[model samples]
Target: MSPALDVRRPALAHAPLLADPVAAALQAWVHADGVGVAAIDPDLADTAAFVEAYGVASDASANCVVVGGRRDGVERIAACVVLATTRADVNGIVRRALDVRKASFLPMDRAVELTGMEYGGITPIGLPADWLLLVDEAVTLAGRVIVGSGLRRSKIEVPGADLARLPRATVVPGLGRPVG
Candidate 1:
């Protein structure tokens, strides 16, 4: 395990991917459905590089993006975008979509704390039930996409269509489309 993955979160479980409740639940959900998951020998923080380095199909890489939440003592919404060739123009789309007064990238600690997913490995699976899931339309084009297993060392390669089954996700246009 890389030293950077030592999230050392308080509520984190001592076990691997099952350490966090959300993570554990996520693993259980995928496993129960018999999701065909695979892991890479090397750790990948960058989704694009992970796809290239691991020979993971580009169309099938789900990048777990953590957009800022409505922090009025509650996380109203968090955007989990798929990993593709571009980035999410949060200011233009996410903010307007979530309808929050303001939207920005969540602090690392806050993101880790709220999502229960390790830094450099945040995935949409096993996140808080209340957090709104916004899936980019382009991601549905892939047959399989590698996503975080709520752990840094592990990732789950799941079918693009199946992602919605894990969580009631909301499909949004221009999630990765250029804002300008």
Candidate 2:
């Protein structure tokens, strides 16, 4: 299938462009099959800069954020995926879904350490099996979306339906609200 972003190349054809875990997942994770990857300047990994530099539509890109909170003195963590044009309702939907009193974005160092990925390049693929994955409904309906490749030097383009099928993923309505 054609990608939402015109610049993507078949991921399997350029495994070196992907991070280790990302490459492994693309090979083994059934949900990531057929996804595309594209090399990009590491300086433009962030959504805004990546979209602008690559001339990709903002809505075609998605962000994966790490969040966590404590309940009954037990910490719980999850990954939230939402379109670049919107922001995850972490304080509301995520906190409730995690069943924690409060939820906050994970510290960069901690997130990077726990996920074994770069701070700005975390993706839902290859995440710890225990971490819940919350994908906004809008993303699943987008047909295709651009996401991190677990590295800053490349991006993955996958069918939105594929993301919804990832292990531990739950499609959440209103998970993301339009950014002001």
**Of the candidates shown, which would achieve the greatest TM-score relative to the real structure?**
2
Q: Which regions of candidate 1 deviate over 4 angstroms?
A: 1-19, 27-34, 69-75, 178-180
For candidate 1, the 10 contiguous residues with the lowest summed lDDT are 2-11
Best by lDDT: 2
Q: Using Cα atoms with residue i matched to residue i, what is each candidate's TM-score against the true structure?
A: 0.76, 0.93
Model 1, 114-173: lDDT tens per residue? 876777777776777777787887776666666666666666656667666656687776
How far is each candidate from the true structure, as Cα RMSD in Å?
6.5, 3.2
Off by over 4 Å in 2: 1-7
Candidate 2 C-alpha lDDT tens digits along 75-169: 99999999999999998999999999899999999998888788778999889889999999999998889999888888889988789988899
Lowest summed lDDT across 10 adjacent residues in model 2 is found at: 1-10
